[model samples]
Target: MIKLKAQDAGLSIAELTRRSVLLKPLPKRLSKITLATYRELVRIGSNINQLTRATNTAIKMGLRPPADPEQLEQLRNLLQQIGRELSQIETEITDDDDIESDGDSEDWE
Candidate 1:
């Protein structure tokens, strides 16, 4: 029997156990392409965040003008690249979803 402490709240231990038993477990592995894309997304996101913070700090400290042309150009390029990559990823996901839906419909026929 499953046991829950008082802090668990709402569901009883038995109910929780029953619900868990009915749920499917997660897959253990992802395709290498998926993993690589996810990692690239993370890396780009982190770089953008760090660059934004650094730019903000520089502005606040009056260390550099808010509109330093070179810095602004670099920031704009980075942002554009991020936007392009995100759009590509979104297209890929939409294509995959369409494929899955087509397969599902076939199963019913």
Candidate 2:
């Protein structure tokens, strides 16, 4: 149908597409959850930083950390989990790019 319209209007498909783009805006390009996951990662990283600072402060001042050995082990586990999640997000983003370039790349014309 677009080809027909472009032919009838005596305009190349590329020209029609260019004019349409000038008249309207493209939608978001990130079609994935990577962005949200990144934001969550930032928040988690900040919390972990604060926890580390507090623990260090307590130790420096000759007080036991509120978080003992067991708690520290749990924190380590949480960090490992977060690392795995980050790796997964990275893989997903890479896969999304691969998918777009997987013989589907096309010129608008």
Candidate 3:
């Protein structure tokens, strides 16, 4: 019998011990779409942070920051698009769970 070491299997000791009994597999890797969404989120976050810092600096200098209506609209549209994409992804995940549960029930019979 071949012994499987945690380190050899590229898993932590705790994860190996815990999962060994239950025999549950690890979660799947992030899909490309999910990764791209996260990257977009980070980019948007950085842009907002830069805007905030600029606004703060202007306030400290007693100068009013000029706002461009077009930029604001673009940010608003980007946010809305992200929200829609997240909702769609969430729906897909929920649907997958439902299908898995249905299949599990058939296995019991």
Model 3 CA deviation exceeding 4 Å by range: 1-17, 66-109
Q: Highest TM-score, which number?
A: 3
| Candidate 2, run of 10 with poorest lDDT | 24-33
Candidate 1 overall lDDT versus native: 0.52
Query: Worst lDDT window (10 residues) for model 1?
Result: 100-109
- Candidate 3 is scored at a TM of 0.47
Tens digits of lDDT, candidate 3, 59-103: 678888655545755775787788678756754553234432333
Residue 44 in candidate 3 has what lDDT? 84
TM-score-based ranking, best first? 3, 2, 1
Q: Per-residue alpha-carbon lDDT of model 1 for 16-108, expressed as tens digits?
A: 555567763322223345456668767776776676677778878878744454675686687568767755665455223443232322210
For residues 38-62, could you state the per-residue lDDT of candidate 2 as single tens digits?
A: 6777787777667777887898999
TM-score of each: 0.38, 0.43, 0.47
What TM-score does structure 1 among the candidates reach? Answer: 0.38
The number of the candidate with the highest lDDT is 2
